[model samples]
Target: MSKLKNIFVFFGPPGSGKGTLAWLCVKRLGFVQLSTGSLFRRHINEQTDIGKQIDFTIRSGKLVEDSVVSKIVTEWLENAAHEHSSIILDGYPRTKNQAETLSQFLSEKFSSVKVCIVRLQISDEKLVERLGKRVVCAEKSCQKVYSLIENSSHKPKQTGTCDICVGKLIQRKDDAPEAVKKRLAVYHSHENELIDFYGENGVTIEDFNAADLVERIFEKFLCRFGFSIR
Candidate 1:
């Protein structure tokens, strides 16, 4: 088995099952998730320095400056080193500049620079529907996600609490109908350029159904790491 650490980068729109898939992957496999969206929310919600710095940018329906996003992600990854050997990255590297920054950082951090970059391709209609009713765990460590509009498999036992942790579940700001529209529009604008940037860096990219079952999605995601979900 390869001992080198692996970073799985997942690209998807707000409600394209990216978070649910990340949660599923972490549950089934040993990998931890490093979600930019989660980080941003924590920052903004807490009104921390970095969160305050990027709050306006996010609320304006624009991408946060690459420097701010990159710095936050780098700090998170650096701190996560001792806790997890594998990481599933979601919501970072939305732009080519961020991709370049990540490429350089990953090259230095891991023995092999090759990464499994997965893109969950979904339609705009589906994304809106999914985010409109998406439920997220309030607990930081427990990111169990469910979409009431879709994915019957991940519905929690309680009305508004996580099935596992019993944490309160809330809809993400970006998951609101209006926010979904803005985020999706931004996604479409930058998706292709990011793909091209990744291709130029020579990382392997995989495309999957954005609407697949959580278990099935992670099954394929784990395959890239030579892992299987039980």
Candidate 2:
């Protein structure tokens, strides 16, 4: 089996640029990016056993059990372990229980893998401001995110259109100013608890200012891992 190197767990609230940083790592370093949301969708589309469980839970208006989510993730890691060295985990292990579960699984199965819990920090006010200006391509297959902020690197070349797919750009309902505030409130509630748990467990933790531009944030992430831009 190929030796896995690093597992980067990106912990951040919404609008903190976790996706952008993960995308950059994948593009630049050829690291495998694993997102729980994407995995859920892929499993459901393929009608896997775990997918059926997730679908049932969602349709019944209940969150999937932490054990179920962890199972699917570990299964994916087992399959991907032989091929990928560096892995970027985005939007998983949201709670302390989930984090503990993942930690145990990694220690037992992938003992040699280095885990880095990267905390992407930004003020809730700034998050609200940033998300409020966010827009995405309306095309289902080309849901590229963009921002209306003048200095954002993700601004579309043409107003109201996606630069890549030429699809109409629309603001997500969840990105509304009021909605963003609600989301941030929920995130802040348990943010410290999660941080404390990771620290207590002796996991390698790093903090980065996520309010910076995407390029700058990517550069910092690379520097943290001793990677240089190719």
Candidate 3:
């Protein structure tokens, strides 16, 4: 039998540091990071068929169907399997049904795929503050992220240039306060049920406050995965 692989699912409210932490983990552990949001954004920017479909759904204020999302995720997993690498899934399996589907799919594909679900707990006020200051690069290949409020950590050198790619940074339409609030509502409505599904499946669910230092949170996650940070 093939060795078991690690699969991490990051759960959090909008503006929670899930994306940041996922990137950090991927960089440190060589985990393939899969984020539905990033996938959709990339597709939409490329104007692919799937991108058009997602665009229509978003513009119409309708949720993207689970079938489409599942297909995308499954395809990615299949590709990752060929490489014999683990993955970190971000902003996926938003509902209980999706979580169940993923669990079954992974069970069949791998001898033993241990899943770890991490939830970043943060207050609504802090979330609002975080989202309001977030910015992203406009270039297709340069989607660098930055925060205006948290100038202490990192800031773009220029008004538009991305610190990573030197591409122009722009605010996404969905990042507006009104849109953020709606997204938050949708997130909270389904989060509890999703959490329960993972918990019931014996998946380790760790909750950490967003205020905790990034290094501290990373250390905890590494420890959970039997890895020690140097």
lDDT of each: 0.79, 0.87, 0.79
Regions of model 2 farther than 4 Å from truth: 136-144, 156-170
Task: Please state the error at residue 92 of candidate 1 in Å.
Answer: 0.6
Tens digits of per-residue lDDT for model 1 on 4-114?
377778888766768778887777676788877889899999999999888988778897888999999988887776677678777777778888898888777755635
Better of 1 and 2 by lDDT: 2
lDDT of 2: 0.87
Which has the higher TM-score value, candidate number 1 or candidate number 3? Answer: 3
Better of 2 and 3 by lDDT: 2
Over 4 Å off in model 1, which ranges? 1-4, 37-64, 111-113, 128-181
User: Which candidate wins on TM-score?
Assistant: 2
Total clashing pairs in model 3: 0
Considering summed lDDT, which 10 consecutive residues are worst modelled in model 2? 186-195
> Best by lDDT, which number?
2
Ranking by TM-score: 2, 3, 1
Q: Estimate each model's TM-score.
A: 0.68, 0.87, 0.73
Ten residues in a row with the worst lDDT in model 1?
146-155
lDDT of 2 by residue, 98-155 (tens): 8898889888989889998888999888888889889999999999989899977778
Per-residue lDDT of model 3, residues 59-176, tens digit only: 9999898877887788778777666456888778877778888988888887477787888998877777677777899989778778776453757777667877778788787887
